[model samples]
Target: MTVTRDSITDFVRTLEDDISRVAICGTSYSDIGGVARVIEQQAIELRNGGYDIDIFTLEGTRKPPEDVSLHALGHFETSPYKEVDKLLTLASPSALNFVRSANRFDLIITHRFPFSTLGHMAKVIHNVPYVYWSHPSGSSDELFEGLAHAWARVQHHLETQNYAVRKADYLCAVSEESGEYIEAKTGREAVVVPNTITESRFGDVADEKKINEQFGLTPHDTIVLHVGRISPRKNIHRLIEAFQAATEGEAECKLLLVGEESMPEYSDRVRELADDDVVLTGFVDDKTLAGIYNRSNVYATCSLSEGWGLPLSEASYFDLEIVAFESIPAVNSLDGAYPVVNEDYDEFREKLCEKVNRD
Candidate 1:
C-alpha cells in the first residue's frame, strides 16, 4: 500500500483502539547482536501492553520472553551470492503459505530486508499495515568493503533497503542520525524510537564470584569491556592495539572482548592481535554479561558505526565509565560518555588509560 501523510495520521489516531495483534519479522533471534535484542524487547513490550505478539524469523536460537509466540522458519543453505539464501527462504512456498495461513496480524513490524520484503508482501496481500524498523542506513560501501561479492551485497542492500523504506506504511529509526540517513536516501521521514536499556536488569548486585570464576579475574583487576560482534566494522583490531598500548605495563588491567565472531577472517585477525591481557569471551548470556558489566571498570567501543549502540546504553545502566570516539552516533547521543576525537588513537589510548587507572 502507498502510504500518505493523511493515511499515516489517521492510522496513528486509531492505533490504540484498532491495533492489538502484532507480527515482528526479522532474520534471527540470537543471544547476541543489537537487532535481535531490539526485536525481543519490542515483543515483550507489546505483549505487556495486552497486544498479542508473534515473532517470525528464519532462526530463533534464543527463547523469547513470556507470552510472546515465536515461529522459526527452517534455515536454508548458504548461497554463494549476497543475501540469496535469505531471499530464497523468505520467498519460498512454505514461508508464503505460513504467512497466508497464519492468523491475521493487525500490524507487522519489520527489521532487515528481504525479511522486510516478506512483510511488504503481507501488506500487499492481506492489507495489514507494516512498519519498517530502520537499523543501519547510509551507504553500504563501508560495511561491505573487503568482503567477497562486495558489489553484489551493496547492490542488494540498495534495492532491498530502499524498497522497504519506500513501501512501509510507516518507518521507525533507532537513532536520529539513522533517521536523517533514511530521509536522505529515500526522502521518507522516520520517527526516532531510540533503543533503551532496562535499568532493573542492571539494578541488582553483580555476581562478582561468577565473574571471577568465569574469566579468572579477581576484584583487584581493572576490567575494560567491549560487548558487540567481533566484526571488522567493530574496529576490534584498533581497539586491541589501543588497549595494549594503554595498559602496556599495567598487568592488573584486562580487556574483555565479548560477543560471538560474526566474521571469521576478521575474528582471526583480532585473535592474532590479542595477547595474554586480552580475553575474547565469545557470546555470554545476559545474566553473565550483566555481571561482567558490573565488575568492569570501564566500557569501551571503537565501532566504526552503530544504529543506537545498545551495549553502550547497557554500560551506562551499570554506571561504568564509557570511552568511545566522538564520531560514533550512539556515543555522541550518550551522556556522561568520554568521547575522544575520531581516529585519534593516541588520544583514544590516553583517555582509555585514564579511565582504567581512575579509582
Candidate 2:
C-alpha cells in the first residue's frame, strides 16, 4: 500500500499513552550490527514516549530493556540455510503463541527480512497491521560477497523478502536509495526515516592522545578506520589492499579494524593480508570507539552493499574525514564524505591517500 506523509503523521499520533502495546520484531537483537542497534534505539525511544513495547526476535547476544516484553525464539548458532531457519523459527511453538496473542499489540513493526514474513503472518492470522522496516528490497550478491553459497542463499532471501514486502501494510525505508528500490520493485510507497546518532552518546569528551597511546601510535601515525562486523560483503580485504597501496609512500599509516568477527575465516583472511600497521580491536565500548574515531584521520569502508551505512554516519558525526564507495547512500548524504565509484579501486586508493596525507 502507498504510505503518505499524512499516514505516517497519523501513525505517530496514534502512538500515544492510550495505546496498549507495540511489537518490534527483527531477525536479531544483538549489538552484532546496525539492525540491532536501530531496533534497540527505536524501542527505547518508543517506550520513553509512553508507548508500551514488546520485542520479538531470533536468539542474539544482547537482550532488550527489562521493562519491555521480550520474546526471543530460535537458535543462536549459525546455519547453512538462514532463510529456512527464519521460516522455521517463525513457525516455532513460541512464535505460534505470539500469533495467537498478537491482538494484544496495537501494531507490529518488523525489521529486516524473514522476520517481516513473521509479522506478515501476524497480519494474516490476527488481523494486525505490520510495518516493514529494512532496506535492499531484494537480496543481492552484494550482501553475500566472498561466501561460497552466496548465489543460492541470496536467491532464497530475494524470494522471501519479496513476499514479505507484498504482505506488509506499509514500508519504512532508511535511505533514499532503499526507498526508491522499494517503490520500483514492490510498486509501493515507503516512508523514509533515516538512521540517527545520539549526540549525547557520541559527542561528549574524547581523548585522542589517550586513544592513540592505547593503540601504541604516534604523532606521525595516520589512522584509517573501518568500524563494522568483519563480514565478507564488507569487502574489507579490498580495503586492506587499498590501504596498502594508499600508504605505500606515507610516513606511517595505520588501519584499525574494529567490531566483532562475523565470519572467522574472512577475519582470518583480513588478518593474513595485514602487516604491523594493521590493528584489529575486535570490539570496544562506545566511549572507546568514539575516542578512536576522534583519533583517526579518516573513516573508510569498501562495502559492496548497505541498507544505510551507520558507521559512516557516526564517522561523519564525529567530524572524521569520510571515505567510502558512492553506492553507499549514507556516506553520499554526508557533507564532506569522499565517495568514489563503487568498483574503482585505483580511485578509491587515491582518495584514501589524499585524505590520510591531508594537513
Candidate 3:
C-alpha cells in the first residue's frame, strides 16, 4: 500500500479501530538521539488519539508522558563492551519470555534492531502484527574503520537488521533514501514518513540572554551550531577543523556542539580538536535546545550520512542558515541549504565562512 505524507495520519487512524492497544519497542527511552525522539513523538501522538500506547524497552531511564505506560524488560547490561551488550540483548531469553507472558498487544511498532527482534517474536508467538520503522543503515564503511572486531559487528548488523526487515508485517522509513535502502537490501517496500518538526514547540522569540548566560556567550558571538550525537559517523572532527578554518581570526565567533556523546573515544578525539572557542553542550532539555537553535547564527553539519537529519529540519524551522555536505542524503533532500563537496574540507570551510560572515 502506498502511504503518502497526506495519507500517513489517515492510515494510522484506520489502524485505531482494529488495533486499540499498541506497543512501541526500542532499546531505550532516553533522549540520546533521534530514534528516541521519534519513539517519544509516536507514543505521544498515539496516546493523544485515544490509543492505548505501551512502550517496551531494554532499559528505561526517561519517564514516558502522562497516560503512556513504560515497561523495562531489564535485559541490558552496563558493560564496557558495547557490542557484547548488544549481542546479549538480541539473544536475551528473558526478553523473549517477557513477550510470551505479557499481555497480548494489538500491534507492535519497532524502532531498531534487538528490540525489533522482540516484535518478530511477538508476531511468531502471539500472532501479533508488527511494523518496523527503518532508520539509516549504520553499516557505513567509514563507521567500521579502525574499530576492533569490525567485521563481526558488520556481519551481525547485516544479519539481524535484514532479518527484521524481511520478517516485518509492514515497513516504514524515516526518509525516501531510507525506504530505497530497505528495498535494495531486503526487497521490501517501505512507506516514507519523514521526520517532522513542530514549530509551536519553539518560542516566537529566542531567549538569547538565557543561551548567552548558559554558554558564556556575548551578543557579538556568531554561533555555528551542530546538534546530534557525537559519534564517528557524524564526522565531528572534520566539522571542528572546518569551523576553525572558517572562523579564523574572528574572535567573537564560536562553534557550539550539542547532544550526548555516543562514542566516547571518538568524542574525546573531537574534544581534543576543539579549542576554547568551541563549546560542547552535551544532552540538553528541549527548552534549552530550542533556545540554542533560536540564538544560533547558522546550523552546520559534516555528517557522512543520515536517515533524515532531524536537526536540519528543526534548524530550517528556526530559519538559520544551513551548511552541510552535498553527499549527505538529508542535505540533498533539503532546499536552500548550502552543500559543499563530500570530504572537501577546503570547500566546506569556504562555504561555512561565507554563510557565517553573511550575517
Candidate 4:
C-alpha cells in the first residue's frame, strides 16, 4: 500500500517551478556506495529537470552536488553505537524528537534499513510519512544465508531490523530480488527503480587528473575499473584472479580497485598478488571513477550475490562489455553481458579471455 507525508499534499505537478526540492537520508554517502549513488543520481536528474533538490544527512560526511542544496540534520550513532541508536529509537522521548525534527520535509526518503521503524514511529508521532529505499542484504529467515554456528546476537539484530523494512510508505529497490524481499517482510509492494547510467560519466574530468597524477597512470594504460567498497562480500579476491589471468600476456592492462580499502589485511592481500599492473585508488571521487570507466575496456564483477549491481549499469553507459557469473540475481541484472556459469577457475578464465578480447 502507498502512503504519503503530511507536508507533501500537492498532487498537482508544477511544470514551471525551476526548483524541485528533494531530501535524501542515509547512513553514509562518502564511499560512493549504491544507496548514495542512487539518491545522488535521482537528485541530478531532478536538477537537470529544473527542480531544486535538497539532501539531508545525519552525519554529513559526503557533500551533495554543487547544484543541489544541502541541509544538515541531527547526527546519529555510527556502527559501533548501534545499541545506543536502538535504545533511543525505542524510548518515547527520543522517538518524539525524531518525529519533530523530520516533519519539515515534503517527502523524506531514507536508505537505512532500521530507519523504516523510525518512519513508522514518526508517522504516528508527527503525521509525516516517509518513503523507504530497500537494500537490506539479509534474509528474514537469517541475517545471511551462510553463517556459522555462533552469531545469536547478530541474528537477533537482523530480526529487529526487519521491523523497519516491514513499515514504510513507499518501498523502492534496484531489482526484483530485493523488491520481493521487501514485499515479503513489509507486506507492501515495492517499486523497481533500476540503477541509472548517464553518458557524462564516460568522459574525462578534473577528478581523473588528480587520480592519474597520484596513481601514476600512463595515457596508454588500460585501467579495468572495479568501483565499490573493497569488501569480502564484493568477492574482490575473485576479481583479482580474473584480472590477473586476463593481463597475463597483455602489455597495458591494469586492475584499478577504486574506493577505499575495506580492511588493511585485504589491502595487503591485493598488493601481495599484484605485479606492477594493479593500482589501488583508495577512495577516489566520482569524477575519477567516471574517467576510469571511460579508459577501461571491460568491466567485471565477481560477487557471490547482489540485490542490484549499480556498477554494472554504469559500465553499460560506456558500452563496456561485462564479464560476470551466471547466477540468478546476477545474471538477471547483467542485461545482455556474457555470463559464464560455474565458478571453476578454468571456466571463469575462458570467459574472462573472451570478454577482454571482444571487438
**Candidate 2 residues 84-155, lDDT tens each?**
455456556777787788888878888865567777888888878788875663345544544445654654
TM-score of 2: 0.88
Model 1 C-alpha lDDT per residue in residues 1-359, reported as the tens digit of each score: 22323222243445556887888878888777788888887777667667788888777888887888888886567755435576567667768875685448888888886667777778888888888887774443554445444754654464335675588887877777777777666777777777776554455555998787889887789999999988767889999999999999997989999999877777889989999899899988777888898898899888756777889988888788899987566687777698889788899999998988784
lDDT winner: 3
lDDT of each: 0.77, 0.76, 0.78, 0.61
TM-score of 4: 0.75
User: Which 10 residues in a row give candidate 1 its minimum summed lDDT?
Assistant: 1-10
Ranking by lDDT: 3, 1, 2, 4
Q: Which has the better lDDT: candidate 1, or candidate 4? A: 1
Specify the highest-TM-score model's number: 3
TM-score of each: 0.89, 0.88, 0.90, 0.75
Tell me the RMSD of model 3 versus the true structure: 2.7
> Compared with the true structure, what per-residue lDDT tens digits does model 4 show for residues 1-359?
43322112121132123224445666555546777776677677766755556675444566677688665444445444343444344444434555577666555567763355666666666655566776653433222233321233443344334655556666676567666766776667877665565444445555555556777887766667777777666667778888888668888667777777855666777678767887777886656677677667777777655566778777767667777776424455555576667466567677777766553
Clashes of each: 0, 0, 0, 5
Candidate 3: segments with Cα more than 4 A from true spot = 1-3, 6-8, 14-17, 91-94, 101-103, 144-161, 198-206, 333-336
Q: Model 1 reaches what TM-score against the true structure?
A: 0.89
- Residue 301, candidate 4: Cα error in Å is 1.3
Q: How far off is residue 259 in model 2, in Å?
A: 1.5
Model with the higher lDDT, candidate 1 or 2: 1
